[model samples]
Target: MTKTDLRHRDVAEAAASQPMLQQVERWSAINSGSANLAGLATMAGLLADAFSALPGELALLDGAPSERVSASGQVLETLHGRHLRLRVRPDASRRMLFTGHMDTVYPADHSFQSISPIMDGRLNGPGVADMKGGLAVLLAALSAIERSGAAGSIGYDVLINSDEEVGSPSSAALLADLAPTKIAALTYEPALPDGTLAGARGGSGNFSILVRGRSAHAGRNPADGRNAVVAAADLTLRLAGVASPGLSVNPAKIDGGGPNNVVPDTAVLRVNFRPAGEEDVRHARTAVEAAAASVARDHDVAVEVHGGFGRPPKPVDPAAEKLFALVRECGRMIDLDVRWRSTGGVCDGNNIAACGVPVVDTMGVRGGAIHSPDEYLIVESLAERAMLSALAICRIADGGLA
Candidate 1:
C-alpha cells in the first residue's frame, strides 16, 4: 500500500478502537429533550467531560435569550440549557467547524426513553440515530485525527448546542457567528439508512399569529362580539391556501377559546412554513402578512404576527459541491459509497450555508426512522462513519478541499 493509504488505515483503526457504542448508550440514556432544561444540563455536562479527551479549550456557555408567543397571546421569554463549545488550534490558518446537538425530539416523559438491541446490528432508542450516535461518531473521528497528528495544520471549533429540534431558537445566533470563520463545516445529523446524505435542504419558518377582539355573552349579545377564534381559524385556512409547489404551509395548531357561555376574545395560531428557496421564502412571508391583514379586516380583529425563518435554504453551490466531492473521495478510499440527494429537511447546515461556508452536514452514522419510537442506528456504522469523517478531516487539513 502507498504511504498515504497506510496512514489512512492507521487513523481508521484508531477510530474503530474507541468506545463509540458505549458512548452512544451512555449519552442516549439521558433525556436531553429541547425543552428539558435539567436533562439538557446533565447531558451537556457529560458531553463536555467526554469531549475533553481532545486538546482544546472547552466551556459551557449559556444559550442566547429566546422568546415565544404564549397561547394566551402574550410573548414570554423562554429558557434554554447551556451549550458546549471547544476550540482547538485557534491560530491555525485552516479552520473548520464541527457541530452537533444535544437535544432530542423526545421529551423527559417520552415512552421511548430506553435503548434496546434490534435485529441485524441495529439499536433502537431515543436520539440514537437522529443524533446521539452521531455525537459518538464525531468524538471518535476527532480523537482519531488527533492521534494521527493530522489536526496540527487545521484547527476546528466544536459546538454542541442544547436547542436544535425546536428550530434552534437559542443557538442559531451562535452558529451564525462561528460559521463565517471556518473554511468548511461538518454537522453530525444522521445519514439515511442506506448512507445517503442530504443535499440542498429547504428552509423552515415558524410563526404565531395572535388575534384579538371584543368579547360578549354568547346568548344575550353574541352579535355584539367579534369571535377571535373564528378569526384565527380563517387565518389558518388562508395560510394553508398559500402553499404551492415551492412553499408548504402547515397551520399546526390554534390556542384559544373558553366556556361556550362567552365569546373568546383572544386566540393564537401556530404555523410552520417550508420554502424551497429564497424566492419561496419571500413569497411565503408576503402571503402570511397579506392573509393576516385580510383576516383582520374581515373579522374586525387586531392581528399580530411573531417569529421568522430560522433556517435559510441551503443550495448546492460550488464550494459545497467541492466539499461533497472531497467526502465522496474519502469514502471511496475506505471502500464505502457516499452519495447525497436533495431533501426538504432543514438543519444547522442551512444556517451555515447562509453564512457562505461549504458544509457537508450528514457526517454521522447510518440510521432510519428518526424523531420517532422506531429510530434505530446501525451499530457497525459507528466505526465506519467515524473512519470516513477522520479521513475527510485529515484530507482537509492536508488542503484537499481547497
Candidate 2:
C-alpha cells in the first residue's frame, strides 16, 4: 500500500463522527431559501462561523448582481447576502476547488422546518439532504486532512454560495473567476439514494418570452384584436415539440390574460431546457427563436426573448474519470461501493467544468427526495461519505492521481 493510502485510511477513520451530525442538525435548523434575503444572510454568517474551524483566510464576499422581472413587468436587480470563501494553502504546488450551497428550496415561512428521525437510520427535514448535510460532510473531511498535517500539499478554496438553488445566476461569475488552472473540483450536492454519483450532467437554461399585441373589445371589434395569450400558447406547444434525444424542453407556465370581453394584449411564456452539449444548446436556442418568430408573425405580435444557457454541460472527461476512479478506490478501502451515471440535472459543477476543470460534484452524504418536504439524509452515510472525501483528497495530495 502507498503511504498516501495509509494516511488516508487513518484520516478517514478518525474523521467520521467528529460532530458532523450535530453540525448538520444545527445548520439545517436555519432556513436559507434562495429568495429569502434575511434568512440567507443569517445562514451565511453561520457558515462563516462553522468553516472558520479550517486553516485559511475566510471572507464573506458580496454576491453577484442578479435581475428578475417583477409582477408589474418591471425588471429589477436584487443583491443577495454574502457568499463564503476560504483559501487554504494558496501557494501549494497543486490546487483544487470545493463548492457547496447554503440555500434550500423552502422559503422562511414554509412549514417544513424541523428535523425528525425516520425509519432505517434516516433524518427527514428541509435541506438535510439537498445540501446542509453535504456541507457537514465537507467540513468533516477537510478537518481530518488539516489535522493530519497533509493540507499543505494541496491548496484549495471552499465556496459556500447562498444562491445555488435558484440556478446560480449571481454566483456563476464568481465560480468562473475561481476555476482557472484548478486540477480538480468536488461539489457537495447529495449523492443518489443508493450512493451513486452524478456524472456527465446535461446543461440547463431558463427563458422568458414576452409577447405584446393590439388589444380590442372582443364584443365590439373581435376581428381587430391580436391575442398575445394565444401567441404564447402557440409558442409553448411548438417549443415542447423541439425536444429530441439530445435536448429536453419544458414550457412551465404562461402569464397574462383578462376578462372575457377584452382580447389579452400581453403574455409571458416561461420555459426550461436541458441540452446534452454545446451543440445541443446552440440548436435548442435556434429552435426556440424560430418558433417564437413564427408565432409572432402569425399572431401579429412583438416578442422579446430573454435568458440563455447559464450552466454548461459537464461531461466525464478522462481527467474527471481518473478522479472518479480514485474516489472508487477510496470507497473500496473503506468497504463502500461507489457507482456513477449521467444525470439530467445541472449544478455548479456544470459551471466549473465549462472552465476546463474536471469535477466530481456528488461528493456528499447519500440521501433521497431532494427539493421536497420529504427530503432526508441517511445517518450512516454522514461518516461514510466524509471518509470517502478525505481519502480522495489524500490521494490527490500524495500525487497518486491528478
Candidate 3:
C-alpha cells in the first residue's frame, strides 16, 4: 500500500476504536426535545462533558430570544435551552465549522424512550439515529484527528444547538454569525439508511397567520358577525392552492374556535412552505401575502402574517461541488463509496449554506425512519462514518480544499 493509504488506514482504525456506541446509548437515554428546556439542559451538560476530551475552549451560550404565535393569536416569547460552542486552535490560518443538533423530535413524555438492538446491526431508540449517534461520531472523528496530530494547523469551531427539529428559531443567529468565518463546514445530521447523503436541499419557511374578526351572538346577529375561523380556513385553502411542482405548501394546523352560541373572534393558521430556489421563495412569500389580503377582504377580517423563511435553498454551486468531491475522494480512500441526492428535508446545513460556506451536512451515522418512533441507527456506522469524517477533516486541514 502507498504511504497515504497506510496513513488513512491508521486514522480510520483509530476512529473506529472510539466508544461511540456507549456514548450513543448513554446520550439517547435523555430526552432533549426542542421544546423541552429541562431535558435539553441535561443533554447539553452531558455533551459538554463528553466533548471535553478534545482540546478546545468550551462554553454553554444562552439561546437567542425566540417568538411564537399562541393559539389565542397572541405573540409570545419562547424559551430555549443553551447551545454548546467549542473553539479549537482559533488563531490558525485555516478554519472550519462543525455543527450538530442536540435536540430530537421526541418530547419529554414520548413513549419511545428506550434503546434496543434490532435486526441487521440496527439500534432502535429516540434520537439515536436522528442525531445523538451523529454527535458521537463527530466527537470520535475529531478525537481521532487530534490523536493523529493533524489538527494543529487547522482550527475549527463546534456548534451544537438545542433547537433544530423546530426550525432552529432560537439558534439561527448563532449559525449566521459563525458560518462566514469558516472555509468549509460539516454538519452531523444522519445519512439515509443506505448511507447516502443529502445534497442541494430545498428551503423551508413556517408562518402563523392570525385572523381577527368581530364576535357577535350566533343566533341573533349571525349575519352581521364576521367568522374568524371561516376566514382562517379560507386562507389555508388559498395557501395550499398556490403549491406547485417546485414549491410545497402544508397548512399544518389552525387554532381558534368557540362555543356554537358565539362567533369566534380570533384564529391562528399555521402553515409551512418548501421552495426549490430563490425565485420559489419569493413567489411563496408573495402568494402568502396576497392570499392573506384576499381572505381578509373577502371575509372582512384583519389578517396578520408572522415568520419568514429560516432555511434558504442550498444549490450545488461550484464551491459546494468541490466540497462534495473532496468528501467522495475521502470516502474512496477508506474503501467507501459516498454519494448524495437532493432532498426536501431542511437542516442547519441550509442555514450554513446561505452564508456562502460549502458544507457537507450529512456527515453522520446511517439510519432510517427519523422523526418517528421507528428511528434506528446502524450501529456499525458509528465507526465507519467517524472514519469518513476524520479522514475528510484531516485532508482539509492538510490544505486539500485550498
What are the per-model numbers of colliding residue pairs?
A: 0, 0, 0
Model 3 segments beyond 4 Å from truth? none
lDDT tens digits by residue: candidate 3, 270-308: 999999999999999999989999999999999999999
Clashing pairs in 2: none
Task: Give TM-scores for every candidate, taking all chains together and pairing residue i with residue i.
Answer: 0.98, 0.97, 0.97
- Which runs of model 1 end up more than 4 angstroms from their true locations? none
Alpha-carbon runs more than 4 Å astray in model 2? none
Better of 2 and 3 by lDDT: 3
> What are the per-residue Cα lDDT tens digits for candidate 2 across 1-402?
777678778998877957888888888888889888888888899889888999989999998778765533456787776789999988888999999999999998999988986677999988999899899999999998898886668899999998998888888888998888788899999999899999999999998888888789999998899998999999999999989999999899888888989998888888999999899999998998899889988999998887789889889998889888988988999888999999998899999999988889999899999988889999899999999998888888888673
Who is ahead in lDDT, 1 or 2?
Answer: 1
- What CA RMSD would you report for each candidate? 1.1, 1.4, 1.2
Q: What are the lDDT scores of the predictions, listed in order?
A: 0.93, 0.89, 0.93
At residue 145, candidate 3 shows an lDDT of 85
Which of the two candidates, 1 or 2, achieves a greater TM-score against the reference?
A: 1
